[model samples]
Target chain A: MTERIVVSPGDLLGDGVFETLHLRPSGPWLLEEHLARLVRSSSILEMPEPPVDRIRSAISDLSVSSGALRVIYTRSGVLNVSVSTIPATVLRERREGVRVLTADLGFTVRKPPPWSLSAAKSLSYASNFAARRWAARQGADDVVWLSTEGYVLEAPTASVVWLDGGVLCTVPPEEAGILPGITAEHLLSLAGPAGLGAAQRMITGAELSRAGAIWLTSSLRGLAEVVELDGVARDRSPWTPRLLDLLGF
Target chain B: MTERIVVSPGDLLGDGVFETLHLRPSGPWLLEEHLARLVRSSSILEMPEPPVDRIRSAISDLSVSSGALRVIYTRSGVLNVSVSTIPATVLRERREGVRVLTADLGFTVRKPPPWSLSAAKSLSYASNFAARRWAARQGADDVVWLSTEGYVLEAPTASVVWLDGGVLCTVPPEEAGILPGITAEHLLSLAGPAGLGAAQRMITGAELSRAGAIWLTSSLRGLAEVVELDGVARDRSPWTPRLLDLLGF
Candidate 1:
């Protein structure tokens, strides 16, 4: 990335909202939903609602760049658009299943702040990045944070999706105080009609481990299965390719 | 404040440490301690140890500007320096006291992650700035955060300092898992020989209200008395200015 973007000093304080979309050769996937969530996230920070039309125009003006399109909206009334090659590690994790760790998130979901942006993609992501970094230092690929009361939350960069007896389950973000994963939510919506059961439940990490299969879902990589969770090797499920194909990964 | 201070795109992320010192006409006050703490804070973030000789030369090259001197160190090995005037509200609060609100910080300080940057002057300060913004919405000058167990931790931008029975007390940073307040530590030390006692104690918001006097200490303002906390009036103690004088505020 070039250091050519001139932003106000306040932008560096992380008082903003952002969206990281899987930029394809044609266009950004799930563009509308990402834009909607960006506005919602900005509102939680008490920022003015961004101009969606201008954003769409900017998207239409783009060329054939299959990379990440990051839209950062700051409190200083700045909108930044930067592109870079899709992170190599994300691709590596997608090819080879990731090793994972788990820890308590230490926050209640029900009593989240009135202006909570948990369901929105916000820019205050240092803690999330730090968690992943911590996991890497511990020889794991990522971490799944549970609530202080032992309920599963989400991962550093992806949503938790696991197979609990034939039912594809993910925690209800509204009840879990987690960012609603667009890809995972879209996948779950399709599961029911495809002769597969879908459900949202408050689960414990141990309960997750007991499941037949577990996967981390996100936009870029689609779904990266947990090959070895905390050094305990697990067999990869045959559902991986099917789910990725359904999501057009 | 100059646009020429070119920074990498990654610098926009708040993975860094920072220090703001009171630049006097004489020199940078408490320069050595500030520099040491900056290094300590960087280590917590796993950043490289800054070159002390380079920093010392930077200070020597600075003009005699009596304002706030800020040093920012990022994990990506970037160090930046800038000078800016303190906000008018800071001086206003110092002279006329301030109204502060109490709120849950939503983090268990006691069990913070081993690599947590709680004691560091980090740049991932969106939450800190957000807390102060929350206070503004609640008609107060600032906020005092409490741990999940209701123990008073520290303010978003300053440290909590209270006088109980002529004894000055501030939270123990290591025990409380919060940042060590340099200004508060300095004042507490100066209070001892000035016929006042000093100590570190674990306190709660309710426990804090019963104190003889309350103050929020920082580098620039020195110390701002809390005449009203959560809307209740507090006694105006004469020790405020005396304590300030001892610290050359």
Candidate 2:
């Protein structure tokens, strides 16, 4: 059933922060990290601190075995938590990988505006959705945004991760001025235990094309491998399953 | 009492478009242009055409003499019309002039991304709200954004207009890739009758400081003269009252 909430007009203006989690039979995956990021995003938007205790209580009361859970907090002090079944498309992307296109985002990482919300997971996701639609129109499943200077930034909804030699690398969040991807950070943190080196470095799009493998990481999708980059088909990497297992996805 | 609507969680994501108009005793100001722009904005976002006839009916049914009327349509096909008292600050800014600041938006007009919604008034207004808050923090009343190339762009909630001797000027919407301001365009259309010429041209931030007069134009505010720019106080322009009367405010 679709969940609904009563909201004032101001609440619909997208002046809010949200977190989507992969709710598993065990619990909402990375609950603490996602909540932490939610608070951080609110701070960035200058919203009042979120009601974490009430949010914890709400999450604990849910009986669903597994699904996608979303926590939203608006500037008008509206808080809502809803859970829905994971989309078939998301699951397909996880299993079969995604055909990706690289496009210039028309933003420079060198100097974002003082009030830039690029680093926050704000509710204003129309552009993100539009970019994906543009990719689909070009016969690709998703897009990786490139800065005007030709540096790889990230996918609209995911962090760009690539394997360079024995290292598992994602873009440095602070340096790139992007939302810190919890899944990518967790994977990189576990790289040593899995016998791999982890690093966060800025990579050019051209250099990224030559990486051993690439993946787009997020909370629910975990990691969707880049099956094809700018129309060139890539050989399936054996590390795909190993990395998925390492993350216990 | 605050009005409310029951909406699905998706409705709050800012994947929508909206228009605000001055609801006057004479009826909603510039109703036709706003509705047309609403449709154009919907097209830009790739959303379905809005239910125009229904919207017309909604407006016709409103009996409140005056206020701010907002029409909002989401990607999920939800349409809402609401009216509320104009804020005291808006009236104050209209009667008095505003202290303005110029900030680099860090976006180049040379090449906006293919999926750019900068020209559309999307509900993803968190960034716009943030910019205003940033301006307020800097001891300014409002902001006029400049492209990375130093070309003056629009303000967060209004369009920038200026007078160069006898010609009234504003940034061309198409060339600047910004939203077309109904109030500014209407004012420019009537400029000749008011014994002033009008033009749409690109002006740099530096050049703007020397203009005879400047104002931020919008539906509700009509025009707020720029009494100050970047910490320097500007003398009150005699044209301020004349322009306000010309707009029938």
Top of the candidates by lDDT: 2
DockQ each candidate and list the results.
0.44, 0.90
lDDT for position B44 in model 1: 78
What residue runs in model 2 are displaced by over 4 Å at the alpha carbon? none
Tell me, per candidate, how large a share of the native contacts it keeps: 0.27, 0.89
Interface RMSD of every predicted model, in angstroms: 2.6, 0.6
Across B1-249, the per-residue lDDT of candidate 2 in tens digits comes to: 698998999999999999999999889999999999999999999999999999999998986869999999999988999999999999999999899999999888999999999999999999999999999999999999999899999999999999999999999999999999999999999999999999999999999999999999999999999999999999999999999999997
Model 2 has a DockQ score of: 0.90
**Model 1 Cα lDDT, one tens digit per residue, B20-133:** 888888888888888998988887777788777877777788865678888877777766666678789988988888899888866786577644678888877777777788
Residues A1-249 of candidate 2: C-alpha lDDT, one tens digit per residue: 989899998888999999999999989999999999999999999999999999999999987868999999999999999899999989999899999999899888988999999999999999999999999999999999998888899899899999999999999989988999999999999999889899999999999999999999998889999999999999888888898888777
Estimate TM-scores for all models: 0.94, 0.99
Task: Give per-candidate clash totals.
Answer: 0, 0
Worst 10 residues of 2 chain B by lDDT: B56-65
Per-residue lDDT of B112 in model 2? 93
